[model samples]
Target chain A: MWRDAALVAGKDLRVEGRAKVAVNQVAPYALVVLLLFGFAFDQDRPLLVQAAPGLFWMAVLFSGLLAVQRSFSIESADGAIDALRLSRLEPAGIFIGKVVAVAAQLVVLEALLAFGVVVLFQSRLGGAGLLVASTLVSTAGVAAAGVAYGALCVGLRARETLLPLLLSPVLAPVVLAATEAWRAALGLSRGDGWRWLGILACFAAIYLAGGAIGFGALIEET
Target chain B: MSSSSSLTRALGISALAAVAVNAWWGLSLSPPDKVQGQLVRILYVHPAVATMCYAGFGLCALGSICWLWPRTRSPRWDRLAVAGAEVGAVFCAATLITGSIWGKAAWGVWWTWDARLTLTAILFALSLGYLALRRAVDNPHSRALMSSAVALLMALTVVLDHYATAWFATLHQHTTLFKPSPSIHGWQLVTMCWSFVALGLVFAWMVVHRYRLEALEERYESEGYLVAIEARRAEGQPVSAAARPETGRVLVGSAASAERAEALVEDK
Candidate 1:
C-alpha cells in the first residue's frame, strides 16, 4: 500500500513537473494578491510588520486552497479517479500521496510569498530559522486536511464555493497557530510562539490519522 | 439496525417535541440575567450548538472507524453513522455562528481567529465540506465509506484547534463557559443546563430524520434495482431477487436516479 501510494504521490509530482502549473498559475496569483495587500495598507512599516505574517498566510492559505482543491478535481475531471479506483491501490495510500503533492505546492507558494513579504513589507528576515519551521509545519497541515477534504467534496454541487467554506473553518486553527508562529518567528513579538508550533504539530498528527481512516471510505465514494 | 415501524414514527414525533421544548426554555422560560440580562440570553443557543458540534465531530471519528469494517458497508450501519455526521456538521455550523454572535456582543469584534473560536469555525467548515463530498460523489457505498473517513479526518482538526494556544500567543480567549461565576451564577447555569436537554433532543431528532431519509433512499434504489434484476432473471438468466417487492427497499430514502440502484446491482 505504501509503495502504491508513493507511486501515486510520485505521479502527482510528475504531472505537475510536466505542466509547471502550480508555480506558474498559483504563484503569480499569490504575488498579485500580496502587492494589492501592500498597496491597501498605506505604507505603515510598524503596522505592516505586525500584520505581515497574517497577510503572508492569507495569501498562502487562499492560494494553498486553490492548489489543494484542484488535486482531486484534476483526477476526477477525466475519469482518472475511476481508473485509480479500479487499479486496486489502497485508497489511504492515494490520500497520503496526494497530500504530499499538495503539501509540496503549498511549500513552494509559501516560500515565494514569504520572499515577497520580505521584499514588499521590508520586514526583518533575521529569523530565518523560525520562519522556515513555521511555514513547513503549517504546510504539512494544509496538505493533510486538503487531501481528505478534497477527496470527500470533489464530486459535490457547487464544489468551488463549498471547498473554501468547509475548509476555512476547519483549517482556521492551523492557520491561526502557524501564522502566529511564523510571525513570532519573524520577531513580531518576543512572547513565545512555541505554543502555536505545538498546535500546528498536533494539527498535522490529527490530519494524518484522519487521512488513514477517512481516505479509505472517500476512495470508495470517488 | 432497523427500527420497528412504530418506533421510527415515535422517534420522529419525539424529535418534534424536543424542538418545541427547547424553544420554550431557550427563548421564553429562562429568566433574563440581571447584569448582562437579555444579552446573556444568547447562552441558550450557544451551548446547544457548541455541544452538538462536539458530538458531530465525535461521530465523524466514529464513522471513519466503522467504515473500515466491512459490515458497516450495509446500508443499515452505514446510514446511521453518516446521518450522525451530517447532523453533527450542521450543529458545528450553528456553534461557529452563534459563538461569533456571542463574541461580537461580548468583545466588540465580529471575528477573531482565536484558538478556540477559529477552531470551531474550521470544524464547521470541515463538516460542511464532508457533506458536500457526499453529494458530489456518484457512487453510494463508496460515498458512505469515503464520507466516514472524511468526517474522521476533519474531526482530527478539533484537537489542534482546541490546543492551538498552547503553541501560539493567541488573543482568542480561553473557554469562559466553565469558569466559576462571579455573579448571576446559579440561575445562568440552570438556563444552560435546560437548554442542553432541549438541544440534545433536537440533535437526536435531526439524526433520526436524516437516517430515515438515508434508509428510504437506500431501500428505494435497491428495490428499484431488485425490480430490474428480477426482470432480468424472469427473462431466463440468473439475477438477485432484490428486485422483488416482497422485500420492499432494503435501505431507505427516495433516490433521484437509478444509477445508484444499478451500482448496487453490479455489486450483488
Candidate 2:
C-alpha cells in the first residue's frame, strides 16, 4: 500500500518536475497577490505590520485554493484518472499521493509568496522561523481537504467551483488559528502560536483521516 | 394519497401559521433587547434560520447514511432528507443575510471575519456551490446522493464556526433562548419559545414541500429519460445518456482496435 502510494505520488511529482506547470502557475500568482495586498493596504506600514498575519495567511490560503482547483485537472484528462484508479492500487493510496503532490505544490507557492510579501510589504523578515512549518501544516490541512472534498465534487458538474466551497468553510478554524498564530509570531502577542499550530495540525490530521477512510466509499461510485 | 395529501395541507397551514405567529410576536409582543433596542428584533429571524440550517444539515446527513447504505434506504425518506438540505440552504442564507443586517445595526459594521459570522457565510456559500454543481450535473441520482453528502459536510461548519465561541472565546453573542445560559421569564421567554416553535414548524413544512417538488421533478425527469432511452434503444443502440451500459458498440469499437491484444483477459 505504501509503495503504491509512493508510485502515485511519484507520478504526480514527476509530471510537475518535468513540466514546471503548477510551479509556473503558483509563483506569479503568489507574487501578484502580494502586490495586490500592497495596493489594498496602500503601503500603510503600521497597519501592514499589524495585519500581517491575516494578510499573509489569506494570501497563502487563496493561492493554495487556486492550485487545488487545478490540482486534479491534470489527472482528469480522458481515461488517465480512471486508469490510475483501476491499477489495483488502493483508493486511499491514490488520495494520499494526490494530496502529497498538492501539498508540495502549496509549499513551493508559499515560499515564493512569502518572498514576495517580504519584498513588497516589507513584512518583518526576522519572523519566518516557523513560516515554512506553518505553511506546510496549513497546506496539509488544505490538501487533505482538497482530496476528500475534491473526490466528492469530482464527478459533479462544477467541480472547479465546488472543491473550494466545501473545503473553505471547514477550513475556517485552521485558517483563523493559523492566521492568529502567525500574527502572534509577528509580534502581536505572546499568546500560544503553537496552540493554533497544534489545532491546524489536528485539522490536517482529521482531514487526512477523512480522505483515507472516505476514499474507498468514493471509489465504489466511480 | 389522502394521508400524504392531508399531511401536506396540514404542513402548509401550520407553516403559514408559524410565520404569522412569529411575525406578530416579533413585531408587537416581545420587547426588544434591553441594550439592542429595536435592532434586537433581528433575533427572531436569525436564530430561527440558524437552527433550521443546523437541522437541515443534520437531517441531510442522517438521510445520507440511509442513502449510502441500501439496507437503510427508503426513497421517500431520502427525498425528504434532500428536501431538508435544500430548504436549509435558504434558511442558512437567511441566517447570514439577516445576521449581516443585524451586525450592521448592532455593531456599526455590516460584516466581519468574526468566527461565527464567517463560518455562517462559508456554509451559505458552500451550499450554494453544491446547488450549482447539482444543476450543472443534471444527473438525478448523482444530484440526490451527492448533494446530500455535501449537505452532510456542512455539519462541520457548525463545529468550526462555533468552536471559538464555545471554547476559545469571541465577541459573537451566544443566544440564551435555546441554550442553557441562565434563565429569563415572563413574556420574553414565552414569545421566544413561541417564535422558535413556530419557525420550526415552518421549517418542517418547507422541507416537506421541497421534497414533494423534488419528487415531482425526479418523476418528470425519469419519465423523460425513459422516453429518451426507449427512443435510443429502439433506434438500436443500448442507449445511455449517463446510464452506463456494460457493453455497447461505442465502447466495443474503441476496444476492438489493436488494443484487442488485451481482450482475452477482459470481456467487453
Candidate 3:
C-alpha cells in the first residue's frame, strides 16, 4: 500500500511539475488574496497585523480548493480516473497519494503566503514551532477532506461549483483551529497555541482515517 | 388515492392535536419564568425543533450506512436517506431561526458565535450540500453512493465540530432541561415534554410522506425511460440509443410489452 501510494504521489507530482499551474497560478493567487486582505483593512497596519493569521489561512483554504480541483480534474480528462481504477492499485493508497500531493502544493503555497503576510501586513513572526506544526497539520486535514470531496464530485456535471459548496463547511473547523493557533503563535492573542494544535491534529487524524476508508466507495461510483 | 398511508394519517392527526394542545398549554397555562419571563416561551418550540433536526440527520446517517453496506444496499435505503436529509434541513433552518430569535431576546443580539449556534449552522450547510449533491448527480446509484459518502462525512464533521466549538468560549446555556436536578418544574416541564411529542410526530409524518414521494419519483423516472424506449422502438430507431446506463437493467425483458408501457405511463 505504501509503495502504491508513493507511485501515485510521484505521478501526481510529476504531472504538477510539468503543468506548473500551482507555481504559476495558484501561488500568485494566494499572494493576491493576501494583498486584497491588506487593501480591505484600509492599510491600517496594526489591524492588518492582528488579522494576518486568519487572512493567511483564508488564502490557503481558497487556493487549496483550486489545487484539489486541479488534482481531480487531471483524472477526469482523458478518462484518467477510469484508468486509475483499472490499474488495480488500492483505493486507500490513491486517496493518501492525492492527499500528499495536494498537501505538498499547499505547504509551498503557505510558505509564500507566510512571507506575503509578514511583508505585506507588516507583522512579526514568532513561535516558529507552533506556526510550522499548525500549518502542516491543518494542511493535511484540509487536503484529506478536499481530496475525498473532490473524488465524490469528480465526473459529475456541476462538480466545479459543487465542490466548494460541499467542502467549505467541513473545513470550517480547520480554519478556526488553524487561525486560533496562528494567532497565539504570532502573539496576537493570549491563548494556548498548543491546545489548538492538538485540535488540528485531531481533525487531521479523523479526516485522514475517514477519507482512506471511504475513498474506495467514492471513486468506485464513477 | 393520496400518497399518505394510514400510518401517516394517524401520525399527522396526532401531531396536529399534540401541537395545538402544547401551544395552548405553553402560551397560556405555563407560568412565566422567574428569570426569563415571557422569553421562556421560545424554549418549548426551540429545543424540541432542534432535537428533531438532529434526529433527522441521525436517520439520514443511518439510512446512508444501510445503503453503503453491500448486503443491505437498496433504493429504499437511499430514499430514506434523502427524506431524512430534506426533512432535517427544514428542521435545521427552523432551529437556526428560532435560536436567533432567542438570542436576540436573551443576548440582545440577533446572532453570536456561541457554540451551539455555530454547530447548527454548520450542520445546516452540510445538509444543504447533501441535497445539492443529490440534485447534481443524474444516476440514482451514483447519487446514492456519492451522497452516502458525504452523509457519513457530515456525521463525522458534526461530531468534531461539536467538540471544536464547545472548547471555544460560549454564551449559550448548558443543558438545563436534561440535567440531574431539573431546573424547571410543573407546567413548564410538562409543556416542554409535550412539545417534543408534537414535534416528533410531525417529523415522522413529514418523513413518511417524503419517502413516499421519492419512491413515486423513482417509479416515474423508470416509467419515463420505458416510454421513451417504446417510442424509439416504434419509430424503427435503435432502442438501445435511448436507454440510459442507470436504467439499462430495468430495460431488459421489461420493455418488451407495449401495453404494459402504456399502462404504466397512464397510471402516472
TM-score of each: 0.74, 0.85, 0.91
Better-scoring candidate (TM-score), 2 or 3: 3
Give every collision pair in model 3: none
lDDT per residue (tens digit) for residues B1-268 in model 1? 3533576577667757766766676567777777676787787678667777677667657756666677654556667667877888778777777877887887898788565766666566667767776676656766666666656556667676666656556875455455575343565666677677768777776777777788887777777787666444333422235543332343222221233455565779
Cα lDDT tens digits, model 1, A92-163, are 788878888898888878878878988999887756776677778888888888777777677666678877
Please provide, for model 2 over B36-117, each residue's C-alpha lDDT reduced to its tens digit, 9 standing for 90 to 100.
6787677667777788888887777777777767787667766766776788788888888888898888788988867677
For candidate 3, please provide the TM-score of chain A on its own.
0.99
Question: Model 2, stretches more than 4 Å misplaced?
Answer: A127-129, A219-222, B1-4, B31-36, B138-141, B160-164, B179-182, B231-268
Candidate order by TM-score, decreasing, is 3, 2, 1
Q: Is candidate 1 or candidate 3 better by lDDT?
A: 3
RMSD of each: 7.3, 8.3, 5.8
lDDT per residue (tens digit) for residues A138-206 in model 2: 889988887777767665556776677666666766678878778767767687777778888888998
Q: Pairs clashing in candidate 2? A: none
Per-candidate iRMSD = 2.9, 2.4, 0.7
Tell me how many residue pairs clash in candidate 1: 32
